[model samples]
Target: MKNSITPSVPARGPADHEVRDQIVAAATEHFSRYGYEKTTVSDLAKAIGFSKAYIYKFFESKQAIGEMICANCLQEIEREVRTAVAEADLPPEKLRRVFKVFTEASLKLFFRDRKLYDIAASAATENWQAVQAYEARVRTLLREVLQEGRQSGDFERKTPLDETATAIYLVLRPYLNPLLLQYNRDTTDVAPAQLSSLVLRSLSP
Candidate 1:
């Protein structure tokens, strides 16, 4: 008989945490200036004054680092959406606010930091965990809004809750998706309000 043992990985120490943050911060600046697709791990290493092997010790690949950045950006948008919805007095108003704040927040990102937007676009295209989780949270929010409307006698209860939420999410997908949003920018100014109105009308009790 032979005995086998697994090698245990060491826990990260304070210095390790500091180095990881340094790598991520430098990578963010590098990616912002150079674009995600254009920049390489070697480039980040050179810019951060670190060896490529050292960088890899913290992140298995460039995409892993990118995932963290993308998640942070999406979290920002989600926070804005939540805040806007929270300030509303009614389900109808909350739903409208979701459209307005979400579109505005996304556009702000796209226009303000296009390099970062490129990473988000890539995340959306690849169905990254961050994007997928964002979309799930959004759908859940929509369902909650619809439920509130029904309970308040503001929305029709005939439609299935999940179906209605899915439909609303689909309606807003063009504006929400980074890739689609670029092409849809021409209509961005007025589309969200108009679409929300149309959806709200359909939901009337």
Candidate 2:
């Protein structure tokens, strides 16, 4: 009888999960220290004490590792914005808080780690999955805030929710997008409040 041979597959147990986390952690540190564009999967493997093939077992490529780091960084900004918005009692305040908090968070990130920020900038420019997902969440949040304002009689009910949200998102995009943020540094401190005020006036019922 002929023996049937099956291809070997990587195990997905707790140990494997730990190793994957370790790899991601290592990659994040490496990318933060040395810009993502200059790093290679082979370099990462050497830095992390793993073979290139073994690293591939955990992540498909260097970009996959970057995606994880980028997603985590974006999630942190989203969390701060969400928390600040939740703390405000009025819908207008919530909307203003969203702009203020998000801009502040982005600025903080840009200054703290320029190298890491470059990854986010690249992700934004490329419209990577992480950036797209982050943008969608922000849009949803804006829509919800507008809906709440209309229901509370603080905002006009004339404009459609999606359209209003998109409009506001476009206004905020320069500050929120990493790729465009560096150019707007001079206005970062004052722009969010001014823009939010302008938006609030338009929304006034």
Candidate 3:
């Protein structure tokens, strides 16, 4: 079912660790399949072949499991952003790379885990721990990249790192909306080279 779900968290570990991981894995699967409101503890437990009580011991509730799953997703997003930021050689280039990398990862995730994706998009407003941490981590990466750009005199906006990061988010945010998917399921609208050209032109002095 659904391409034979394979959980990222490993399976063979200490019994306790395996149980916890299995619960997380099961929750990820169910959430990816059914989303937040529809996914239930029993479904997760059955998916993992664990008793309901066993699941509770590892996670107090579905929301707890959700936070854990979101944390995992955030960690993944941070990794991708960090990679993109690390690879770029210039400020304008960094923004372009970050946008492309973030967009590709998001589109992949949006299809695989739409609810969690939405959860992250609204995390700033929802005040969810997972979302908060996720945004914080992304901001940290942005700051680091901008600091490098500052040394190179690449950023002329005089905006604080946080403001600039939010601005980037503003620029990239609309593409992640569900409606945008109808346009070639995450393609079209702006080809990478064109988007990069637009960003470079706007950001360059």
For each candidate, what is the lDDT? Answer: 0.83, 0.83, 0.61
Question: What TM-score, over all chains together, does every model reach?
Answer: 0.88, 0.90, 0.71
Q: In terms of TM-score, which candidate is stronger, 2 or 3? A: 2
Please provide, for model 3 over 101-174, each residue's C-alpha lDDT reduced to its tens digit, 9 standing for 90 to 100. Answer: 76777666656756655544444345666655555555556566666767777765566667876666556554
The local distance difference test score of model 3 is 0.61
The best candidate in terms of TM-score: 2
Clashes of 1: 0
Candidate 2 global lDDT: 0.83
Better of 2 and 3 by lDDT: 2
Candidate 1 accuracy as lDDT: 0.83
Model 1 over residues 1-205: C-alpha lDDT tens digits? 0112111122233435888777778888888999999998998899999999888777778887887777767777878888888788899999999898889999998668888787888898998876777788788889988998999999999989999999999999998999999999999899989999999999999
Given candidate 1, what's the lDDT at residue 1? 9
Worst window of 10 by summed lDDT in candidate 3 = 1-10
TM-score of 3: 0.71
Clashing pairs in 1: none
Candidate 2 TM-score over all chains jointly: 0.90
1-205 per-residue lDDT for model 2 (tens digits): 1112221222333434888889888988988888899999999999999999998877776777787788778788887788888788999999899889999999997669988987887888778877877788888889989988998999999988899999999999998898788899999889999999999999988
* Model 2 residue 163 distance off true place after TM-score fit, in angstroms: 0.2
Among all windows of 10 consecutive residues in model 1, the one with the lowest summed lDDT is 1-10
Model 1 Cα displacement at 107 (Å)? 0.3
Model 3 misplacement above 4 A: 1-16, 33-35, 113-127, 176-202
